[model samples]
Target: MLNAFRARFWDLALGSAMTVLFALSGTAVALPLAVAQLLPLFWRRRFPAAALLIVGSATAAHTVLGMARAIGFFPATIALYTAATHGSPRVKWVLCPAVGVAMAAASAVRHGPVEGLLMAIVTVTVAWLAGMERSEHLRQRMERAAAEDRERLARRVHDSLARTVTVMLLQTEALRATTPLDSAAEQRIDTVLGAGRSALAEVREALAAAGSGPALGPRLEMLRGAGLRISGHPPARLPAPLQDITDRLITEAATNALRHDGPGTLLTITTVPGDGTLTVRLTTEPGGSASGSQRAGGGFGLVSLTADIHGYGGELTFGSRHPAGWQLEATFPALVPGHD
Candidate 1:
């Protein structure tokens, strides 16, 4: 609404009326310069710096002529505000003061030094301050709106994509067990499954980057119900990255365990904090079927999990435990409060 009143044609019409009023008030001697000063108000919003320069030049011309100094002040004030509010930081900090000082010197030369300089200083200062305040308020409001948008997007990823990936994992595991497959078919299945799982982990990591994500507890429970027998009590407060990394580690370890072993296999998940390091360990019974499984590479999810852990100065080690099972252990440094 305010901008509409300051629109190009509207400003021109208003300026014309102001010019006619000044002429009627017996200040018509500087009519041409005053008119030139006010005319550029038409493009104040689109080209604030140029408008300020034009208006400032005209104001200086009329003030030096000692004919219509007051007539130009109104348009010059409006142009100053436009420059401060819409100009880039360099223009706002530098060009605005330069234009104001030039106009102030003209005003001081025309009127008495005390009154003319004070009027010029106060008018330009107040207008610039008002414009700067408004700019800062608008900037803060936009930042808040952007943060809310990111959180909303994170929630959507959690509710929709996370669940879809969970279902995909369960379906893939079940299909691998029931269906008989040749070597090529088994390799193809592993490739598809690993790709899907890696994509899901990447999505989770991205959402967590925005400081919002699904909790680890619910995801752990879902995995437990799917196939693997899991047991662990995670801490109440963990960094979002660590929680996400741990969740991926558990999912990948469980998937690999279920793929290799029979239904009787027991997978144990444990979280332990000691000596400034939080460790998550997954143990599974090893030595299952090798008929069509165990291709060239192991699980691709392991590679993804290793990168995630290493990013936080953590380490992940996996190999056969003492007598019967495989153990995958990830150790992360405990983060101080407010650091994460």
Candidate 2:
């Protein structure tokens, strides 16, 4: 909304300046034509092709009517640049050249063929090329930023969670060696050891994949073995960062559920893929009395997860479900940042 307001404000200011310039130049008769040539620029970024067509048409009319050439040329060139920069892929390449040619023909009416062609080449063609270059530069910069973010996330997971899991694995090993226990208790400890080992391996894989590894299938199987009543199938081949976030979200949410709601908690995980977006939902019902209480607002894990999700232009929401349960849902764009 703020961006739209600023664009409109810029267009208004440009239009006003052009109108004033015409009025002061003793071409007051062309003020109306100038307004027509410049008004469509207000929507130039939002509706680039349509805006370019309207602005180009009005500028052509303005030139043919013997109006101030500056008034028509300036806004037309701006529209051409915008069309090249932000227009839909289906129309951008086609519309820009067509509009450039039309505007050049109009210029010829006043400036003659040779000068008009030079003006179009120098202004319109240059503007289009500049816009394309700017667009490509912005895309490369955004991709680099996204890659950096993924690397940072991978480092955090390696430094924090991986170390913690290592400690847990060592502790479980020491307990089994030093303490006497019945067969059943030994089996439970063995289960913990297996889970810790699996987690450590998964963490290593995540680091190797730059936070985008970890097969969801095996993780879900492990969770099921841990007695979580799981449902829903995982989507295959999610984008790198998205798959990473999804894995982390599920791990964090399930850990909280098992800690707070205890073993045998019914967990329903669903993934819904939509037009350029993916939504994941996890719902957990308390299996019994609380094993532990979570800190207010779901503790640091959820807080951190929320920040990560938002960083990817996604949303993460969680709250208590009615009739005693917890729910978490995340929705994000399916594509990586700067990707098509």
Candidate 3:
């Protein structure tokens, strides 16, 4: 409501100021001609083409009267600018040139033909160009803002939900291998794995649409390279976001294990998928040269990861395990709402 009032105030102010200027100009037809040209300023933005026509017609009348001064000049220029900025392309192209011709003809009657025509054409051209430049700048600014927002969302998705998904895939694969199951049970596990892969693909597509940089790639391999022995095979593909989260979790666990318990620490990761939820556990056992306590501080990475997990209705916990190890566990929805 306040914005509407502010806009109306400016429109009335411009029109009234122009009207008063012409009234005090001491020309015979100045007051009436200025009123006709400037009155449309109130609706110039809302009905640009019509406003331009009204202002242009008054300008033409001012020219025909052979007034020594062009009282309609300022109002006509403002109307032309509004048309170029807000009017439809067809209306803008058609009306703008017509207004320019009228102004040039008026100027020619008042001054020398060549000088007046060039001056009026230059003035009209400048106003139109200014409006076009402003429109382009606004468009570019909006695009930049949208791109930034997409990038931020992509990062959050990758860090939290994607990591959780990766752990689920790894654990499911492990469960298939170590435990003998009936054919029906095996098929169900395969379906779950397939769904995990599909979810990952969707995350990749979303990141691509957002124009984020390169994929994180093969988190399982990354963990193995960090000297953690792998007991289970990951699915053929994992979603980019989940893969990133899994990588961070595994990396942080491995680092803490090696740092606190010396090199050659054993790390175990497991996943259990229930009715509508999935649980992941990462345990670290001290190496031969173990020294410090297993209670590691929750760093910024874990804090951020915790927030991300909670955002999707998940829970996370990490601490010293028994008398000999450290463990981190998280449980979250198997499929986040609205994601499928």
After TM-score superposition, the amount by which residue 174's alpha carbon in candidate 1 deviates from its true location, in angstroms, is 2.4
Best by TM-score: 2
User: Model 1 — TM-score against the truth?
Assistant: 0.55
TM-score of model number 2:
0.62
Candidate 1 minimal-lDDT segment of 10 residues: 287-296
Candidate 3 TM-score to native: 0.56
lDDT tens digits by residue: candidate 2, 1-340: 3544666777779778866766677543466767667678776665667888888887777777776665457788888776666554444577788887887787787778777657755778888887677656654665566678878878888889999999999998999999999999999999999999999998787688763355566766777787777767655665455666788788887777776787788778899764346789998887765433433477888898898888766789998876677889998754432221
Q: What tens digits encode model 1's per-residue C-alpha lDDT throughout 67-157?
A: 5555557788888877776666666798889988988888888786787888888888998887677656555554455467568878999
Measured over all alpha carbons after superposition, the RMSD of each candidate to the real structure, in angstroms, is 19.4, 8.3, 22.1
lDDT score of residue 214 within candidate 2 = 51
Query: What TM-score goes with each of the models?
Result: 0.55, 0.62, 0.56
Compared with the true structure, what per-residue lDDT tens digits does model 3 show for residues 43-156?
876567788888878876776676534554778888887777655455556778888788888777776677677777888888887766654554455445546756988899
Question: Can you rank all candidates by TM-score, best first?
Answer: 2, 3, 1
lDDT of 3: 0.68
Runs in model 1 deviating more than 4 A are 1-28, 67-71, 180-184, 210-340
Pairs with steric clashes in candidate 1: none
